[model samples]
Structures are given as C-alpha cells and as structure tokens.
Target chain A: MAVIHTDDSGDPRLDDFRHLSTADRRPDRPGGKGLVIAEGTVVVSRLLASRYPVRALLGVERRFAELAGELAGTDVPQYVTSAETMADVVGFHLNRGILAVADRPAPLTVDDVVTGAGTIAVLEGVGDHENLGALFRNAAALGVGGVLLGPGCSDPLYRRSVRVSMGHVLRVPFGDLTDWPGGLDDLRARGFAVAAFTPRPGSVPLRELREHAPGPVALLFGAEGPGLTESALAAADHAVRIPMPAGVDSLNIATAAAVAFYELASGG
Target chain B: MAVIHTDDSGDPRLDDFRHLSTADRRPDRPGGKGLVIAEGTVVVSRLLASRYPVRALLGVERRFAELAGELAGTDVPQYVTSAETMADVVGFHLNRGILAVADRPAPLTVDDVVTGAGTIAVLEGVGDHENLGALFRNAAALGVGGVLLGPGCSDPLYRRSVRVSMGHVLRVPFGDLTDWPGGLDDLRARGFAVAAFTPRPGSVPLRELREHAPGPVALLFGAEGPGLTESALAAADHAVRIPMPAGVDSLNIATAAAVAFYELASGG
Candidate 1:
C-alpha cells in the first residue's frame, strides 16, 4: 500500500476528495462515469474486493491502519491526515473515518448476468435510488442470483444507492435490460418463468406461484406508486401478488421485493 | 367541520403547529407528550380515521377542499391558509400541503393488543425511528396483528417515523411490553409461541417455523447490529432463522422482519 502523509487540505492530490457531495456532478472526468465511492472500512473493503479499480483512499491514520491487512496487497495510494484535515478536505465531518474512490468498470451485459442464474429480480421504472439499493441488498441476502434493471431504473453506482445498499450493489451482479419488455422475453427464453408482481385482480398469490413454477424464476417489480406498466405485465407469463392485509396500500417496493425473494428462496 | 380563514402565521391558536420541528422539544405540553402530528392528505386521512381525537387541521384551501368529505361530520377547527403561511407557521416548507394535530390517546396495554391476535412482532432495541416505522409498515402490510416494543424502542409517534411508515404506524396496534424478557412468559401464558429471530445455529429456519408454529406466534426481533439479547432468546419457545446467503451480513432489520412476517402470514 502506498501511504502518503500530508497535512495540507488543498493539495492537488486531494482534488478528488473535495466537496465530496458534488464529486458526481462531473461524470465525464477521468475516473469513468463519476468515481464509485465506498465509505467506511466495511464498504471500502468490499470495494477493494470488487472488480472496480480502487484509485485512492482518504482517511485518518487509525482508519487506514485498521484496513492495513486489506490494504497490504493493494497498490492504491492511501491519503493519511488528521481528522480535522480530513473533514476540511471532504467538506463534512465524516464519522465513517475512511473513504475509497474507484472508477466504474464497463457494465456487464444482461446476458452476462443472466447466465446460469436460477432466481433473478427484474425491475421496471424503479427510479428511486434508495429503493433500488435496498432491493439489491435484499436480492443478495435472499439468494437472488442476479438483478436485471429495466427502463427508468436509477444507476446502482450512485453514491446514495451504494451507501444504502451497504455495498451489496457493488457485490451483486447486475446489468441493464435495455430492451424493456423485450428483454423480459429474453429472460423467459433462458428457462425463467417471468412472474410480474402486482395486486390487481386475476393475479395468483405469490405463495401459489412458488409451487407452480419450481424451476428458474424472474420476479418483476416496479416503482412504488405506479407499479408494473401494462406492457411489462403483459409480457410476463404470470402475475403474482403478495397477500397483504386489507385497507393498506402496497408495501414499499423494496419490502415487497424482499417478501417475494424470501418466498421464492424458501421454495415455498 | 369548523372552518377558519387565517392569513396570519403568528396567531396564538396556531401554537401547536408553530416551530413544528421544535414542538416536541418540550413534551410536557398541554397535550400528553406533545401532540401527535400527521402530514400530507393520505396520512391526515388515516388520522381522521384513527381513534385519536383530531384537535385541529392546518393546510392550504385546496387541501381542505380535498378532505371535505372526511371532515364533513367532524367539528374540529380547520385553519385554512396559503402554502407559504402554512410553511411559516410550521417552520419548514410543507410539501405535503396539509397537516393535522391529534391528542395522544391513552396507550393500549400489551394484553389489549395481543388479544385474539394470531401473529405479532416483538421488537427489542429497535431505536432507529425509520426502521421502527418501516417495521410497522411491514407489520401492517403483512398480517402481523400488532407490534410489541421491548427495550430501547423509539416513539412511533415521532414525526419522522409517521412519515416514513406512510402513516401505517398510526393504523397498527402497538404497545410497550415494559417487563422486557419477562413479558415472553406472559405471552406464552396467552398461548403464543415466542419465536425469536436470529442467525445463531440451532435455530429453525423461518419457513420451517411457519410449519412448526401452527398456533399463535410472537415473532421476535432486535436492532440489526446487536440482535436479540440472550434473555430474550432464552425466553423464546424456539429460535427462528432466516436463510441468508453466506458472506453477507443480515438483511436490514425491517427487511428481515418483512420476510418473517410474509412467511408467517402465508402459513407456509
């Protein structure tokens, strides 16, 4: 690990860490489509383990030393400074103590993610970054082999999404299904029964769908307010619903996705 | 409804809604522990439908007109103001356009909530207001009959929790089990099989628990980091586990609870 000791906050080397909140404003910079940031030691460790190339790390000495074992084999420069200097450079009191910036790698093709995947979550119009992140976290925890993002989905690499997902967005394999409902057709061709989740009439309960389709399954989701579009629903082989109590709106999309993933993963 | 036109934000009658963020700072106010507040038409509608006495309403003329039906028979004061005035009174921009203040009714006892309930969620140390709110939302959507708060739980009536829960926290039946782990014995006496959720070995998977617990079950949860305490676990009739992928930490407490609620609700 290349440890660089510096007391200056305005040093040219610290340019990437300045006004961290606005770092993503210029995505056309050298570090791909914005630098993929991982906060704290845990997420930074995951970032280091991921395929994303770690460009640099900024942290207090203790934080860098805490990651010394993980940093030992890595070649990226680690910026060491006092907590005050670190705060001055980052424009906030980052209690996380450490941060890492990485360049976003070339995205995986939908085919790359779908290959040999048994259970996948196909999302449509999930533009809310937090919900997108939570869905990825749930997908990873519940054994969903991959995620296929459809139209109107936010970037999983967005800083807020990465933070909310606890870096699972970095771990889980995902790729944009650019073809909309047509991409869902491709998933079906790959031996997956595309099940669209909605509470509308004529839909089978999710529990029943678990038994009906025992092989590969692609569970489809949409944004919270307006669920799966007509085209997206029509493209699916089945419409499944989670049984919710009366007089309540549908669950948050991520929570709904978690329930579906649990049911499918449990093979119930 | 008793409608009043108020262009002045400094009106003494509007004190309850003044400096709303700091309104709860002094809990020992005229109303017990500050007034329960509901923001937005959707949440205000739930407040109207709730048993809590609606003391007064403040909103734009358009919002008041939208709720004309719900307020038809009620005699509560509806202070109509412009959006800007409403914001001035509330000390923040009111995007929800409407707000309702309710007197906190006497809390229901644990026995009151557990009576005739088939399933309940027992939470310990879930201090995060948003997580508590989301758990309540999940509890409402999934058929968890009620929530039992143990130690370190935050007030569900906190403004943030209410907003984040989509106001389902208002709809859900919840009560504090002040006896801590000893409350488990009381629940067992009420014929509930206490099943604490944790990832420790020797715990039955949540799906298998559904089959094993054919009778009323109390699903136990704790905060995400430090899960249920030993005393809580020891008191449970069984320890239940959600099947999670290896290498990942547990799912967010709310998401995990949602999966458990769904599993128990589906009776799989």
Candidate 2:
C-alpha cells in the first residue's frame, strides 16, 4: 500500500472523493459514477475485506496510521491530507476523518443471496436509505442470511445507507427482484415461506411464525406508512403482524424489520 | 374554540412556537421556557391527548380543519396562519403544517410508571433525542408499559424526540431516576426484574428472558457505541444479549430495544 501525502485539495487522484454528497445521489445517472463509499475506520476496514474492489482511501494522517493493520494486505492508493483539504475535496466536513471508495461488483442474483439461507428479509417500498441500511445491520446481527429488494427500495450501496448500516450493506448479500410480487414465487420455489409483515386485520401474530413456517422463512416488510401493497400481502404465504396496541402508529420500517428478524431468529 | 386569524410573524401570542429549532434545546436554561413542543398534526394531536397542559396551537387553515374533531373539545387558542408565516415563526420550513406547545405536568415517579406495568424499559446514557424517542415508540408498539430514564439520557419531551417518536413519547409514561444504579432497587422492590441489555460474553440470550423472569420485566438499554455502564449492568438482576454472528457490530440502541421488546412481548 502506498501512502501518498499531498496538501493540494484539487489533486486529480482525489477526484473520486470529491463532492461526495452530490456524487452519491443517483450515481447511476449520467455524470454520476455510483461508487460504493465507506466512512470511518470500521466501515473502511469492512470495505477492504469485502468482495467489492477497493479503489482508494482518503483520510488524515492519524486515521491512516490507525488503519495500518488493514492496509497491510491491500495495495489501494492511500491519499493522506490535512482535514481542511479533505473537507474541501469532499464538499463537507466529514467527521469520520476517513473514507474508502469501491466500485460495485457484478450484481448478485436472487439465488446468490438466498442460496443456502434459512432466513432472509424481503423489502418493498422501503426507499429511506437509513431504514434500508438499518435493516441490513439488523439482518446481519440477527443472522438473517440475505436481503431481497422487491420494489421502490433505495440503493443499499448508497453512501448514507452504507454509513447507517455501519457497513453491513457490504456484508449482507442483496439483489433486486425485478418481477415485483411475481418474483416471490421464486422464493417459495426455493422452499422459503414468504411472510408479509403488516398491521392489517386478520394477519397472524408474528409469534406463531415458526409454527406456520418451520422451514426457511422470508420476512417481508413495507415502508413505515402505507404498508405493504395489497398485492404484496396477498402474494405472501402468510401475513404476519407484531400485534401492537390499538391506536398506536406502526413502528419505523427498519425497527419493525429488526423486531421481526429477532422473533424469527429466536424461534428458529 | 376560538380560531384566531394571525398573519403576524412576530405575534407574542405565538411565542411558544417561535424559533423552534434553538428554542427546543436546553429549555431549562435561562432564556429557555422548556415547553413541550409537538410538530405535525399527528404529534400535535398526541400532545392534545396527553396529560401535559396544552398551551396553544399554530398551523395552516387546512391542518386545523383536518384536526377539527380533536379541536372540538379544547378551548385553547388556535392561531391560523399561512405556511410562509408559520415557517417564519418557527424559523424553519416545517412541512408538518401544525404545531402544539404544552406545559410539563408534575413529573411521574418510577413507582407511578411501573405500578400496573408488566413490561417497562429502563434506559441509561441514551442521550440521543431520536433514539430516546424511537425507544418510546417501540415501547408503545410492543406493549411495554412505561419508560424510566437513568443518567445520561436525553429528555424524551424534546421536540425532535417527540417528532421521531411519532408522538408516542407523549403517550408513554416516563420519569427520571436520579439515583443511578441505586434507583434500580426501587423497581425490583416493585416486583420488576431489571434486565440490563448488553453484548457481553456469558450473558443469557434474550430469547430466554421470559424463562428467567416469568413475571414483570424491565429491559434496560444504553447508548449505541458504549453499552450499559459496568455498574448499571452489575446492578441489574440479569444481563441479557441478543445472540449475533461473531465480528458483527451491535445493533443500534433503539433497534436493539425494539428487538428485546418484541422478544419479551412474544413470550408473554
């Protein structure tokens, strides 16, 4: 690994780290190279270890020194600069003091995520980056094997999502399901029981989920408000609810996912 | 109820809602009124329904009309203004379209919150307002009866906490415990088993929490990074953990709380 020191904020090698806030938005669009970004030492280390190809790292001297162990194995460019130049290049004061950018690997398949997995999370309309990231973090913690994004989900590889997931987005395998509710059949084909989480009436209590699906389980979650679409719920093998007190609003999407993940993990 | 037409941004009558961003911080300090503020119609309605004394409301005409049923029983002054004027008063562009201010009632005691409760959440060093608020929301959703704040916890009534909690903070009962770990004894005397949540080794899995405490349970939590202080953990009757894959980070404080809340609620 090369430790390149420079005080110039306009260095071309730092272009990948420039204007990060705007650059992260719609990276798939023209003029937007949707590079996977990991912030801080923990996330940076995760990025270095993950399958995603690490492009380079930009940080202050102390942060680079702190990550020396992780850098031992990688040959990625390490740009060391003062905090002022780092902030100028990134278009914001990054308190994390360190960042690692990686190009997205070849997209994972639905099979790639769900293969050899007993428990997985399926999401719909969960467009909030923080919520999506948090779900990955919870899924990782609870031992959920993978995540399958159905529709209207945000990019889990987005910088905000990566940061919020504490870098678990890189660790948790995820893939887009282009067929919408139709794709749920594939999960069922793979012997996964699809359970849609909803507060709608007549849904089975989540506690009984293990009894309902003793084999592989796929817990489906919708956005906080305007929960799972009628089609999504109808398509699931079972509609489950956490059984909250009447008159209380539904839990946040990610928090709800965490609850369901814990229940399924514990029961299994 | 009197519907006052107010276009004046500087109206003294609307002072409670002025410069809300800064006004919400350290309300107990000099030049700070420490009023409980609720933003958005949902939270405003909750503030109206809570035990706190409703001071006044400021909102656009549309939001007022939407909350007509909730407004019917109250004689409090309702100041109607355009969105621009409302924004000017609050010093931000609040899309919530409604706001309510309330005076804190006499504080509830630990005994008061835990008296009839089968499940309650005790928090320590949870100084983040959003996390504090989300924990209350989860507590309400999972049927945890109340919340007790230990040292280093943020004020649940803070404006941001109130909003993030979706107004559940107003619904859930909470009180400060000035005695640190010593106050935990009061809960035990009241027939509550105080279980401190931590990822420390040798701690019992959270799934067996019900087995360990069949009766009432108080799930104690700490902040995100630094978990429960050693003294707090040692003082508790039990130390519980949600088993996770090795090398993964701990769950977010509130997300962990929700998972624990679900586990206990499911077993009960």
Off by over 4 Å in 1: A30-32, B30-32
Query: How much is A127 displaced in model 2, in angstroms?
Result: 0.9
Instruction: State the lDDT at B178 in candidate 1.
Output: 97
> How well does candidate 1 reproduce the true complex, by DockQ?
0.92
Reference-based TM-score of each model: 0.98, 0.97
**DockQ leader:** 1
TM-score of chain A of each: 0.96, 0.96
The lDDT of model 2 is: 0.89
Residue A176, model 2: lDDT of 91
Kindly report the docking quality category of candidate 2. high
What's every prediction's RMSD, in angstroms?
1.4, 1.6
Please give, for residues A123-172, the per-residue lDDT of candidate 1 as tens digits: 99999989998998998899988998899998899888898888998989
